[model samples]
Target: MACVLEAPLRMSVLSEVTASSRHYVDRLFDLDPQKVLQGVIDMKNAVIGNNKQKANLIVLGAVPRLLYLLQQETSSTELRTECAVVLGSLAMGTENNVKSLLDCHIIPALLQGLLSPDLKFIEACLRCLRTIFISPVTPEDLLYTDGTVISHLMALLSRSPYTQEYICQIFSHCCKGPDHQTILFNHGAVQNIAHLLVSTSYKVRMQALKCFSVLAFENPQVSMTLVNVSVDGELLPQIFVKMLQRDKPIEMQLTSAKCLILTTLPCLVRMCSKDRLLEERVEGAETLAYLIETDVELQRMASITDHLIVMLADYFKYPSSVSAITDIKRLDHDLKHAHELRQAAFKLYASLGANDEDIRKKPILESGAIELLCSLTQSENLALRVNGIWALMNMAFQAEQKIKSDILRGLSTEQLFQLLSDSDVNVLMKTLGLLRNLLSTRPHIDHIMSTHGKQIMQAVTLILEGEHNIEVKEQTLCILANIADGTTAKELIMTNDDILQKIKYYMSHSNAKLQLAAMFCISNLIWNEEEGKKPSLLMHRQVTILIKKLLLNSNICSAQCIGIQSVMGNIILGVVWIVGVVRRHEEDAESSLGETQGHSDNKQELERHRGGFHL
Candidate 1:
């Protein structure tokens, strides 16, 4: 009879908790947020583990008010923290509950809450975020586009052991793809997370293992990265093996096996071997290209593996040499095979040399791969041309003067101009990029432009005046800016009226970077740093006035502030020079102080802005 009474009593208590949960949720909008928050916290704990009860409260509208209090109740850290805790409970309830929580900008608000100096508040918010990230409804790739978020979270990894655990869980859920893998790896995730493998807390250590497994799942480069990363005098592989071999639980040992059994690294190397199988080689090349495309460390690692770059570059020489095929019947198949091989090889070259110069350029130059790449750029195949041209761009990036000259000469001026005029905007953009890289530094600009100035300028004018997009035009201005950096090229640049007219038009461009790019040219042409004078004050009078006016109205940000400083310095130097000449040439007391100034409007313009410049 007493046992029968216990069930009724428990039901009555649970009923009261649900009603209290609703009452506090509704009272959350009170003038004082603190009054109802403790009740909310207590009631939330009672209903938290009950999925059905959580779904019922969400239907009664708890999640939205909690988010409001989290975002708005800034003065009360306790209120926000409770709200975050309750939201975490709701996030773990059901798919519908997670969906409702995610619908109202909860992720970004929680991200903001994580920045608070209140450690408890941050922990609550991080746990809430971890719950949301764990849900199938809240996929990470949809939320994050770059490694920026990872970098921010990784910055907080050492705040506490709990922070490390939650952040690792967040990374595990969020890092589901290759892009995320590369991003997290780039933000020092390997080293930071490895330290947690030795943490005294079992939760932190396990979570760190989970993150590595998610990061290394099917990703050979990252798997290799994880295995080799040293963690507190213990290797990651050793830790995993010890977890499996030691007295850990069956559950943990199973997880260790799952995370440690990644086979991608060995498989990728085998797939990339130099057997005579064309289709397999093509697949291998494309996959490896994707793997190392964004990670420079992976590129460096792959380059040191038994002369991998040399072997990849040889695909262009042996497999694709159509003339080497003498048999009549196999000619068609060989030609098809050759195109696929070259395309894949070019794609590899583009990524292999993307971030590192010595990796690909050394082997490519030694093996004379540049000539083959140059020849492929003229191929009628659209993909072959694009990939070939992009590889050349990387080859020329930050290269010495001789390499720039070699790339330009190898492509030949006529072939380059044809590339510029190619009907494909993608190819044209790449050609413009190649030109930018070739003419990137002072010596590179002087040497490349001296030999191909006419044709290059013609290409510039063609792109600038033609029906290309604003990006094409912007890069064209950048090219002009690079030309203006030449010791003797500034004069050559100022002499071209069409280029000058285009520069003037872009000075007022709606895009700020484009406008700054044009100003870069103007700054270069007029400002002479070494001589401390205006080298080519020969800019059209109207162009000079336009620059002055734009200077006062420009909203250029810090990235291009150097352009602004250069323009301001050049214009002031001219005024100061003219002022000094008049002061020195004065012969009598008849000369007034006004004689030393330029036009009155120009003087007032300078005077108005001069106070704003420090130097």
Candidate 2:
């Protein structure tokens, strides 16, 4: 115990034991059979629990001695097992230990032991080989160049389920580098890994999945081969989907998801090149989209590929037709497939443009995504409409003015307005959001106001009055705020007393965003008002009270609220004459008994003035 506690003492003891063990091991073959077995047993026991001790033994020349025993024709199975166990322990130690084993040429002996009839010998040999394979100091060129090591591992994969997991782990370690991945695939390792996916042992299956995932990652040829290989008429894609089931272990699901992403890379490259058949291209796009659906990094990677955006854009335009299928069930299946393709395309488009304006321009707008999305909004399928509107919404957010105009021209104004009445809450919500984004462009706002102001106003009012979704109402308020930017539009909105009332009501609502949006609309409505033209009646006592409450409410204070307060201050300053008129009325009332009633009547008159402001 003291030796374990003190590093120098431990090293001294290990050095003495290793030196004596080396002397015994050197004369092991010359000794009697029982003595040779005892010497090897003693060597194995010396390093069983201590990696530093094992490393010391390797430094003292135990590796070559152990390799000699493994290579001996007359060595007993017990002697060979002990030799393999010692070698495995040595290989599992420091980098110097692995380097010593490789320098002593022990890999061939370990490979030989893998073919032994004894399961324990084979397992020990595999453990050592796996350790060497994973060691950073191990020469990758040496292990993969001869092809013999990979072949032996593939052989062990078929030997027994007990050994298969270890062999799979070895393959996983070897498949780390691109050069090694090519070697493994060239030796049919990818196919073997695919076969092991159906292994009854979950451990084997997981290791195999990991091996394939490592092989598939960034190795285009390996990815292509895995996807092209078919077993029982099912490709690797189908098997990966099956492994991604909800009931499977999370590790398996995660591995399968990653592998699926890698497997689709080659297909995507080919699709981008336009070198594949239409069916193949569509299949690849669908698979890639499914694997990277909600994953941001993979989506970014997929978006940057050469022809991927163009290919997906074309698919968006001409979804696979389901009419060719004659059977009703097949027809249903094909229809669902078509719908999935459209959904995948739009989802990918949304992800691609979420952060990149170049993607929005090149892949989305220039690729005719706007036209396709416009057409999709008229589809009978609710999912397609919802996805199309959502994609359009993202496209319009913070977009260039010219791009916004192009999108507006591409979309059918009537069709878009009709979607505002959509039964699906999601569809309506997305449509309202899209409208809000479109209104961000000043030109688009002017066009909508001049051509379709009444319809647009009606749509917003209907949603505000009838819709229940808070998000939709918030978007509606944003649209009203934008529309009120123009004088004619402001007058149109202000004449509608109900719209004004709703805006005033929302100003005091519990939701801070709604309150802000309504305040913004009110601020824009009263912006730069003339003294005589001011909506004195509309700025009723209750309206002013609400604004004062908002100003004093600590919880409601935000950056946007502060901006609104500045605007409210400007509105008050602009209507200084109105304050003077109220003051004069107070003075007139102070001189008479009827002044109190007059003050009350004038307050009611101011309330009526609030209704007339064209907000």
Best by lDDT: 1
Per-residue alpha-carbon lDDT of candidate 2 for residues 539-574, written as tens digits (9 for 90 to 100): 454444444444555544546456445445444432
Residue 140 miss distance in model 2 (angstroms) = 5.8
lDDT of 1 by residue, 1-615 (tens): 011112443355355456655675567666765566775676577675787667656656666777777888454888788888888887787676677776666888898887798899999989988889888888787547533667778888989987999999989888877888888877888888888878899999889888888887656667767766766677777788888865897766877886666523434445566664777778878887887789876666566544566677667765445567687766776666777888888887887788777865676676777888899999999999999999999888777777777788899988998999999989999999999888776666777777788888888888888988878888888888888877776666767777888887887676766776777776566544443233354235544554555545555433555665555554554445434434443544354344433344554444444321110
> Worst 10-residue stretch by lDDT in candidate 1?
1-10
Candidate 1 global lDDT: 0.72
Candidate 2 collision pairs: 494-615, 537-608, 537-609, 537-610, 538-609, 538-610, 538-611, 539-610
How much RMSD separates candidate 1 from the native structure? 18.2
Whose TM-score is greatest here? 2
Candidates' C-alpha lDDT: 0.72, 0.70
In Å, residue 317's CA in model 1 sits off its true spot by 4.0
TM-score on alpha carbons, each prediction: 0.51, 0.57
